[model samples]
Target: MSRKRSRLSSEEEMSSKLSDGGCGEGQNGSETSITSATSQAPIDALQSLRQAAPYSTEPEAIAERERCHYGRIPRAAALAGTAHRKVRVYSDGIYDMFHQGHARQLQQAKTVFPNVYLIVGVCSDSLTHSRKGRTVMTEDERYEAVRHCRYVDEVVRDAPWEYDEEFLEKHKIDFVAHDDIPYTTEDCEDTYALIKAKDMFVATQRTEGVSTSDIVARIVRDYDIYVRRNLARGYSAKELNVGFLNEKKFRLQNKMDDLKEKGKKVMTNIGEKRVDILTKWEEKSRELIDAFLLLFGPDGRLSNIWNESKGRLMQALSQPPSPRGSPPPGENGDSHSPVHSRSSVSPPPPKSRRYETLYEAQAGNWMHRALNVLATRKRPHSGS
Candidate 1:
């Protein structure tokens, strides 16, 4: 009877401990089973999310789920649920020039599972160039870009072009996430056939209207414009890989574009007032013409004054000279006093020539007197 009583006490103690959430080696199996049972609702919710259409717009489902659940939506419930370890997701890409598209793909992969360890794989430059053409960024740069993403947890460099069982097992990847579109290569129809066959592929929606190829195409389309813009921003022609002629051409084009833009702005500012501006310009031009005419035109004040002076000069030239002092009382042609004869038909000699002739005559008279004195002194000296 004591043994039975001790056995009952032991059993009761175990049951009490289990009920109080006690953990022990013996109770671990039972605890796991109970946890699984309790996690069914969240698991079901996650399964529903997965099965739902990618672009479903039905708000009733969300409303119903919100009404039923009280806590945050469980992440990675399909594989590990919220109570288990996080699901490991692997996504591979060239991821060159890390744009919004790459970011969105990683984001979708991250949130597709509530708790996720996102591992991004970047391909090597040689592999990419051999199979997928050249990439804008080098392998190391691409790896660093993916590593710094907020959604990425790990970065794998020189990732394989195609996934195999060994690679997946090595990474312990739970799901290989990418776009739904099949990636075809020369050797095979789809590179991800193995992953898809193993049911490890998770499809992420591709963001429309943007892609790396599209971005590259745009750059190619506006090649000159971008080069010119970089040059304007202090980049050199050699850095832009432009030749001398092309650089000059691009600069000229840029100048022309700038001129066009300036002209457009000027016209926009002028708007509907161009006619008024022309009219004002015409008024200013007319005022200038009037001022010019007033100053120096054929009928201007200066022209009139010149015409009057010319008439006075012609009248003075046409008139006869007045006689001076009535020719000094009957001296006519032989007058010693310098005077004009009223009776003479010809005009009198000028004062300058008259004074010159008078000086010459005085010099001649002095010379004759000297000659006469010399002749008298040396009159043959007859007595001697």
Candidate 2:
């Protein structure tokens, strides 16, 4: 409950500052602004909102430094010794993803009168989820978002759907700030009727263009990215509730031939491109699967190529070049070193420095290492 207070002289101006109807005034003509309390952003008449107030900070010195960077107005007011009654303006909502609209609404509410304290109540996730399908933000998240709004002085978690006389009296609520429209839910007949009858309803305009649904729709439109992201996170297609390609096979088997033969009748270039992409993807995956199977076979035969190639190269390299021929070992003490003859298998001509851009076939270091390991482990005595 907030203390009772008097309206400011800027009543007329305050009305225009909110929506066209002016921010809501209580049953007694006390005023304040509203907070949209849905999981998704609200969709309503659009208006050009004023710039949002900067985030609150502790320590005036620190605040000053940050404000200087953003060109924000210093937070200050001269209500210390004023004789005016302290006003308590009440407004609340789900406030799922708080933004400029929420800020604008709250500002209108608290600033509608002098010496104001704004109390905002955020609905519980259970309540919100029951009424709405799904909320992107949790109940706690919504509470924090609304609690920090520049307009809010206090926040109530799991706020009640309708106001009660006791709640009003305890807080000394002078005016309940909200739009004039009826706020009916399963829990209450008219959420604001009691306040309105007491003359506390204030009408604020709904900001347009941005809402939770709009944001959700944008993500859905880029569905492929969503699927890819889930995969990257180690979530399988089944885990993501995606249908298996086998299930969608009919879509292709039955229609691909028709599309290729008479595709122009219904399919455009865009459709053809998609078909080609799918075909290419399938072919590529098949190739990779076959390659891996052979490479990791029981005998690991793929490594044999590596060993054979390295053995030839090493044998060629081991032979020393000789300027003079040595005679074969002679009988008795007169012996001579045997002349080593050049083998038919000679090292291929020094490799030409082929352009890497041309991508000539070459066995990379890994392949060579694999072959060498296989050849070194072979047991001639245990040959089958």
Candidate 3:
């Protein structure tokens, strides 16, 4: 009986050991499973994030990126509401020269919808012509150019007709953006209404002086000479009659008058042999008057008086000396002589008519002649 009891106790001890070892193994397995699950939690979270994130290269994705970069909604995006937080701005144009004014407008639009994305709507060349007569650049060129702007987010070809609510709603637009100019109202009512209906914002910002029309006007003005020449060929008789060419003629006539006054003065200075002075005066006066009339007047009766006067002066200056020797005692030399003997002849009276006319005509001649001489004179002492 003592042997049987001892054997039963040994058997119980073995069973107890087996049970405890089994429990220990089970606990180790549970810990391994928990560690595996914890390691996989981050991987599962990353997979979910990847699914929720937007796809790059998609229009919507591109728009969002642009909005984030510029910190505002695009004009077209604002006009086309795709998201509740997104603002749509609609600016349609050829966008030929993307200058500071364009930048300012985009900047202003962003200011209105700080959280929205921007979508640029570029008008096709055909569509632009329907509204703006003509555009400097083509549609493709405008699109490519505007797309490169840092302020511009996305580009789409705008429709030919005016903006409609259906179009705005399809895109989920929130705002219609424009420059703060009063003239844009007539054409933008439909788009404006859509923005209001959507409870979206309407933003108008000030633009700098950079407009396609203004640029074209400046180009025309700067090349006025070429434009005028072409215009003259195509202009009708009535158009030509409005004194456009006559304005140039009038200016020429004034120049002739100035020359006439100058000649008159020169003649007055030649005193006693006054005929010689008068002859020279007539010739120079005629030349200036002829040049004036040639420029301003028709090819009619105005004579080449200046040419004739110049010929007469030359002939007088070239005449041979008098046949007889110097004049009789006490009498001054020949009237036409240029002798400078002060003791031989008494001075002419100050009140002489010839002297007076000479003084008047030559009053400003010396100064003018001096200026002309100085202008044409070679500079010997040039710093260079």
How close to the true structure is residue 183 of candidate 1, measured as C-alpha lDDT?
Answer: 91
- Please write out the lDDT profile of model 3 over residues 140-198, one tens digit for every residue: 67776766655554566654345665666544444656653333445564534544555
The C-alpha TM-scores of every prediction are 0.55, 0.40, 0.36
Candidate 1 lDDT score at position 302: 98
TM-score of 3: 0.36
Output the TM-score of candidate 1.
0.55
Error of 3 at 286 (Å): 48
Backbone collision tally, model 3: 29
Measured by TM-score, the strongest candidate is 1
Write the candidate numbers in order of decreasing lDDT. Answer: 1, 2, 3
Local accuracy of candidate 1 as per-residue lDDT tens digits, 185-246: 88889998988887778899998988889999999999988999999889999999999999
Off by over 4 Å in 1: 1-83, 260-299, 308-384
Consecutive 10-residue window with the lowest summed lDDT within model 1: 52-61
Q: How does model 3 fare in lDDT?
A: 0.56
Identify the candidate with maximal lDDT.
1
